[model samples]
Target: MNWYQTWNNPLKNLLWWLVIIGMLGSLPLAYMRHETETSTKNVEFVFDYRDLLDIADLQTNPQKFVQDQLGKMKAAGIGSMAVYESTLAEFKESRRIDLYNSRDAAALTQTFGDPSENFTYLLFTNNEAQQKLEPLIQKTFADLGVGVKPWSFKNRSGLVIQMSPDDAAIKAMDPDPIAMQMLKDQGFQLVVRLSNHREFKSNDMDRLLKQLHDLGVKRIIVDGNEVPGYTEENTEENLNKMADLLNKYGMGLAAIELLKEPQKGFSTLAKQTNYNVVRLHSFTEKDGDKLTEPLKKSELEGRIQGVADRFVLAVKDRNIRMVFINGHAVKSLDRAKVVDPLSAYYESLTGTDGAIPRIEKFGFDLGPAQPFEVHTTSWQKVARVFLLIGGLSLVVLMLSFFIPEGTLIFFVLGLIGLVGVHVLSANLYAQGLALMTAISAPSVAVMLAIRTVRSGASAKWKSGIGFGLWLLLRTSLISLIGIVYEVALLNHITYSLVLQQFRGVGLLHLLPIAIAGLYLLFFSENNTYSEKLANIRRILSSYISVLWIVIAGVGLAAVYYYLSRTGNEGQASTVEKLFRSYLENTMGVRPRTKEFLVAHPIFVLGGYLAVRYRHAVYLLFIGVVGQLSLVDTFAHLHTPLHISLLRIFYGLVIGAILGLILCAAWEIVARSWKRWAKPQLLK
Candidate 1:
């Protein structure tokens, strides 16, 4: 005989294989799809721009600034750029001179007419234009002591110069007319800087515009950092006022404020005015020297991407034509003449002809650029845990099949293993484990029972009795174990010694009755016992299915009820009313009962059936009566009842009608199955 012939037939084997494979594949797919879809729908992204600004501030040191900025940008989901050596000494001195004089002056007077004649200028229009002006501005400002304050001159000539310490001295010396003429001869345009800290007056703003027009200041870049206590409304009003003045004077306002709180309003203004504003921070910056320890590139990318996303959203439709990203955002350059890679990426995304326009870079130090990628290896750890559990279950199952005595041992071990898994998975995979155990345990028990009973030596009454008793014992034990594990153990009930004592006492009373019942059932009838056992199995299966459906339906209904009742109006007071009505109809006597009956006719009729047919279908009728009593009790609690005694009696009558429906469904399924399975024909 072939090895396969010793076991199941070809058809049985094929059917078993198909069922197993289909269930295994389908269940995982269903569960995975549901989880994925739920997570995708529910997960939300929250962006905070302030945190990015703080991170950029922390990257003050040139060496670690780029790496630190990058790290923060990834974490905060925003991008920034910090321009290095952009502010020249002459610019700062001019600002201070204006600030000190404007605070006390009577009227706007030109201390130095055409101040642009004393400064170097560079205009950024196109790449070719920038290259052509770069060398010209560099040579013109070199060896020429632009007497202002401590200022460093670099390759770029649109110098962001600092404040002059000796403003009075420069005014006294009157700065050689020829040198002043040399600045004018070089086509220089002085861009005056304004501090946000200065209190704005309507008259002073008018004077400032006139002064800018006299000095040939074509653009005024406002320092956002200096702006104190500027609210959204204040900033908008100030910018609009400045825009009006600048429009009158044929000059434009360039903003360099912290793109933090007032960005939305600023963007709105930018859109309305068609003014382009450049951010002065990089994507990320870091501390510590690279030679000793380097920050993770993956971490930095995440930070940069976050900032970039925010920047894109904030100015996507703004009038801002371009953003000059700070070079320090990518890497630190000592010479302050290198381009930043992150700046280039921003430009690529939000510049002219780019995916998103109005972003560029004023690179102090730009370097080699790399492609962006996100790291998602955290999920691997969770996957490993699931794989381990599955592998262990398979190993135990396979081992059990190979060993004869091992079957029972392994069954016990599997139960223990599942208990351990339940405890462990509750923290890691609670719902998945719950669903797995719910489906697996019952299926496994049924399969094991069928296999054990089918291979029996004889279809004797003793065997049938033994099988039924064993099944009952197994079910009872499992239930007890479940209660202990789920409720007692979980609740910190550590009375194992007391439980053992109780079990010992209970066994004395239970053993004899159980033995006698087993013997009686065993000796009754072999064929009848088997038939009845099969029927009982079918009934049990149906009952379990029905119970599960009831549980799920009731649970869902309860959730809906809770949600519906929770908003503003307060929860419905149904539970108390139903309870009170149940007691009134069921326990009240004579006249009191008559009054209750007259008010609830359905309940009265149901009570009559429960009292009269207290045998065959009374249990079924009682269930219906109980349900109606609950509803009536809740109603009574919620509102004062104004019905007549006859109406009460009529409500009980309605309950009786529903009781009849319940009995009909029950009998139909029971009788239908019985008629279909004729034991005599099978015999």
Candidate 2:
């Protein structure tokens, strides 16, 4: 039959109409679900040149490469870069590091040979040693090269010098003015980073300021320079000197790790200074530049969140501007491994108006009187959800009473109950548990309902198996639907926020399946044991001896399982990534796959099959199978909530399409079976 004929058939036509209605209706939901990429552009990015390449890569055209990478960094939302006095290559070239006492050369050697290894700085820890060795190194470098000038003092907790290399060695040893100018032209803020080494006390400070001023740097980050708990009596001279330096250079200061002791003094400084404070928190202490793996699900995001919380408090209390820098994938492929999770966590912690991101965009708006709050739950939103649930419940009840749609009423009631359960829960995981109850409760009800009606009926054991698989398919679909609505419209579910929803759900979800099985065996209908052969014998006799068909089904199921496991199975994979990337590139956001492909199809197919094959107990079995799929899908709470909702939408679309095909094929099989089996099976 063609389109007209198919439409004339009630089952096929209703299935199509359901698909059309679901897809069309979902368009609005998808639109509402669409999200904008939250910008972290306010973040100041740090680049220790040694993190990118070693002395070897800097042999030729290194500045060109470094400049290109900096361009990429700016494009990727880094607002500022910090300049230290020395890098490994510059140290190695100075020819003075060799004259000093031997230290661990591992950091320098690792970067030299491996182009991929460079995510950390070679932190020379001996400030005392460096202070003593500085003059010798400076004198040695001045004599070693022609026209070599040491631009000195205070960086990385040691005394070091930035050398102006001779014309011939410029590309190999020093920063090019042209490339530095390009960075400035690109609007990249340059900050001179210094430490509290003793050599920076007097004449060295003046030289440092003049050098920075000439380099177009207007910001400075000084560590340990300000006296802790600085009071008028002890720090009067230091404060005067700092003010003079700030005024003369027209530069701002960057403070870090200054909140712990004498907080009130820092608070006083925060009001008067334009310094930006960064909190010290390392995600990884690994050597070299490769990013460590992302935070695992087991380690509740308290480490990061704790730091952010404390940082926010200090910043607000002090009225200071703050910036967040990462310890993982700061600049490389798979940057989102850390960046996105942090962004999502901060959003939850601080909401859309997060102080950190706000500081990045607008800078230090916290007045002396203003207090910062991470986020507050909108009671208005909660009320809206409550009102919607009540209104929708009433509508469903009205439709159920007027139309006498038992299954629709039951399912709609189940959905409304899910929302109530989710809203009443403490968090996303609890909400998911409530949703599972919703998926299973109706499923158990349907199974019990089927048992009551089909208690006196009978069927071939082979048909019973098909019916079981069919019920599995149905429950999975319903479970998927609940998850989608719960995730997208209700909760901001993500891996960082919620634990896996599979706990306790699997057993409860499976209990319904077991109950369905019992109903099939005892209450409903099934082939009885023969005089010599039992339920097994009848099914063997009834099922056609198509070895090829059995093999084909196994192969198809295996292929589907493998593909599903690898592709869009539950977790985001390469396929999901590529598709999401395309969507994000084109549409700025992506939806999940299981929505259209897995769960939605199961719902349409399972419901229609349950309706058509009510007497055979087929749909319930398939719906049960579907419930398993749905459970497995939710087992992956590692996915973002929006993506999960998208998956359900995709599943519904695919399920409806395939449901049409399955219905058409089963129609022929049903007719043939009527002739071969007892007419009572049809009833």
Q: What is the C-alpha local distance difference test score of each model?
A: 0.33, 0.41
lDDT of 1 by residue, 1-683 (tens): 45534332343333334333433433332233223212211111111222223324434353255345445433322222211112222222212112222212212233443433333222233344344433433333342444322212233223222223233222211111222222333333344445444355556668755754775545444445433223545776766675566567766444432344442233433443444222222222231122112236655444344344434322321112223332222333553432234343433343333323312321111111111111123343454343334423332333332233343344346557665765776433332332232222222322232233333321333432233334423422221211111111111001110101111212222232232223223322234556767755775676456888898799679546634433224354666434544553343311122223322233232222332232222122212222222222212111111121233344444433443454455557768777886654687
Candidate 2: misplaced stretches above 4 Å? 1-50, 55-59, 72-186, 189-612, 625-643, 668-683
Estimate, for each residue in 608-655, the C-alpha lDDT of model 2 and write its tens digit.
455435543554454444444444444444333344445444454455
Q: Say what the RMSD of model 1 is.
A: 29.1
> Distance (Å) between predicted and true CA of 377, model 2?
4.2
> Mind sharing the TM-score for model 1?
0.22
Superposition error at 102 for model 2 (Å): 5.8
The lowest-lDDT stretch of 10 consecutive residues in candidate 1 is: 492-501
Best by lDDT: 2
- Scored by TM-score, the top model is 2
User: lDDT score, residue 430, model 1?
Assistant: 31
